[model samples]
Target: MSVTNSFDQLATLRAVLLATPLFAVGLTLAAYLLGICVFQRLGRPTWLPAILVAALMLAAVLSLTGIPYQEYQQGAAWLTVLLGPATVALGMPLYQQLPRIRELWRPLLFSLPLAAGLAVIYALGIAWLLGASPTILASLAAKSVTAPIAIGITQQLGGSVALLMGALLITGVAAIAFVSLLARWMGIRDERIIGFALGLNGHALGTVRAFEIGPTAGAFASLGMSLTGVLTALLLPLAWRLLTLAGMSVGS
Candidate 1:
């Protein structure tokens, strides 16, 4: 090839490499849109989550093609990077719900700490029973919160990021699919309870469903989810360490 043509070809290849992440993002977006359309056509309930379907499809394709997760993540990480700003964007909804929050300040204040404590207890119990490493257990604990916060907490607590991502996805999907059933079984349909379940248990997907339910529910759910993250980050590890020390003391 001529020197000019060679340089042009390399430049084109570089552009393609740079565009690869967009392709991953596009695949996820297309899957989401397709899922919505398919679910709507089937007349499925709003609770039928589309993200799980998209994630499964993408995972299958990646597995079948033998594309290294490292390469895929290189492009996929861009989408991950945007997750921070997207989470912060929820402030818009929370802002509108501020007056209601003030009216229910006592309940809101009470629920945050309670939810966080419950989360830590549940995670540690499960981890101990499953024989998970400290890091894996920590990652699992982080799973109930938003991705950016979960990831940061996971790293700080010595958890596997990949495992944490998987756990988070599973937790969110389960909460979306089953929380309503759990609520109805308990004879509860209060928006606050529903919203708290979503935020505390469901993360983003549950919060999305909460928004559909009503503003009050959505507001509380967002608060629950956000504060749970804060609580998990601050206290889960310390509690874990204390519990471990207590056990060691007893054993000795």
Candidate 2:
């Protein structure tokens, strides 16, 4: 009788949590806040940054509670909706630095294609070398862009959007969390270089991480992200075609 009653109570609680939107929203905000606090208390180190901590905590909570991703997303969607506006707001600071940025436009034009092309080449090459399936490779080809854009590209390429999104999210987080350390270790100074690399490789998560370093880094990162996004969108299809052609040539 006691065991049966405990199971009944647990089921009741689960249903209640799933029904309440606040449950998911509150949990997400709280997790991020706690992550910030923990990161600060640890002396603001990069290895365990606040964003990463918050993400892990949220993941752990969801896993432990057995909450479906859809259920959590219901509440988190409100916050996710703000991402675009927030990123756009970052452009103001970049705008203030436009004179400096303008001076680099010539370099920017030359570098943009190289950066975008290399990103796609490396992603596809590594995946191919690892012997990933064509579907998986197709999905991963656009992994550097934001998820929505990536999904669109994946669809055009006959890949699963779901698989693209999964890989996309993982790479975004991993890049944001570790790229700075990697940059420093590799002796790549210059905020512009760091910021640009972060934006190109990390996307939104990298932009956020760049802000933490300094305003200048943030501005450069925003530029890198915007440039890469436009370039990637415009060139990805052509790049994919060439890559496939090369693959066919090599195989033959």
Candidate 3:
């Protein structure tokens, strides 16, 4: 009777795991931890960051298990909610770097808008060249922006939030690899420059990488990410409307 009871309890546990969101959350955390372990074991290669490893692991699990992404996202969405708080927490670093920011205010003011605009333009241009649909082009527009802001932009443009998320991840990894390699090639050792580039090009992931370099680099990365998000949010929509109007005028 005791042996039968043990088997029954195990069956109940398995049923509970399959029925609840905890399984998804647990799986995600486990995958990330394993990714970190693998990343460390592999000597922390820039091309294979922990996040990428985690993502690949998750992808493999889902593929192998035949789990629908929508089902997985049901539980995973809880983690996405934390991005807002995480972003707001950057204010501390921003405050700490105020003096440096003030010292570089002039150049920052001049370069930020130009850099932000270029980021959007390049993404849209590439997607257009590939004959992507308008929805995809819009989704790619905010790939370099952080998640919360990117989601809003994609929704406003009638793009898929799902696609935007994927683009953001790809952009982050690509930006890290690109910046690291180019910085090494050009012998650009300034953390500020590196951080700013990462933030501008990679968004949240870039800021995380910057923090690994040092506080100053991390702070600058936060500044770059915040300013880029603001600029892109405010200007991209307006620019899009104008271009849309002009296109309609031309069509008529």
Candidate 4:
């Protein structure tokens, strides 16, 4: 009788787990629609992105309901996996912008290191100051790249992939919401500067916002996103390992 009861419970649990994806998607779409309504009501400022609000609302709902992040992630993994193909698709537009890229190599080359350095430095410094785990710090160091690349680097560096994902999402949203305002404040209104700042700090969402701004901004944003990914992937692990070797203990 106990064995039969256990089997029934297991079957029920399996059924619930199988239904999780549908639940997640339904909730996500509802949240996005609600966010759009809210944004429209709020006058649709560039500093108040709909996607950010939607994601935050969903996150709050899931947290309040005690949903295991694993369950939500299982449902969301489809979009995560599609990111690779989507990134590749960006290359089509990038190809059209090749001449512009070539013309700006001097500034682009200089900006790559400067932008990447600031990202890592700011993140690592803050994490360390907070006495965060080495793994958390390492994950922070990868937060600016696309999801797949960020996840890969985080895993290799012994960081939490979920933490890295959360950081990336937060950074992307916040950057989109604030970078334009920041650019205006600093008088950094050049299209390339605007795009590069957005991409280096915000990644894909920033690129999306840049496209909304204008073609020139989008081109630079795309380039910044691509280069940030390549540089962060190639350099961050070595930098972490070097830190460990240098008695800094970045991610042990």
| TM-score pick, better of 1 and 3 | 3
Considering lDDT, where higher is better, how would the candidates rank from best to worst?
3, 4, 2, 1
Name the candidate that leads on TM-score: 3
Residue pairs with backbone overlap in model 4? none
Candidate 2, residue 72: how far the Cα is off, in Å: 2.4
Tens-digit lDDT track of model 1 for 190-232: 8877887888888887888788789878887788788787777
TM-score of every model versus the real structure: 0.83, 0.80, 0.90, 0.86
Q: Evaluate all candidate structures by whole-model CA lDDT and list the values in order.
A: 0.78, 0.78, 0.89, 0.84
Q: Judging by lDDT against the true structure, name the best candidate.
A: 3
TM-score of 4: 0.86
Number of clashes in model 4?
0
Clashing pairs in 2: none
lDDT (Cα, tens digit) per residue for candidate 3, span 76-175: 8888888989999999998998998898888888889988888888888888898998789888989999998988888888889889988998999898
Model 2 clashing-pair count: 0
Overall local distance difference test of candidate 1 = 0.78
* Runs of candidate 2 exceeding 4 Å displacement: 151-189, 237-252
Q: How close is candidate 1 to the true structure, as a TM-score?
A: 0.83
| Model 1 misplacement above 4 A | 1-19, 45-48, 240-252
List residue ranges in candidate 3 displaced over 4 A. Answer: 1-19
- Write the candidate numbers in order of decreasing TM-score: 3, 4, 1, 2
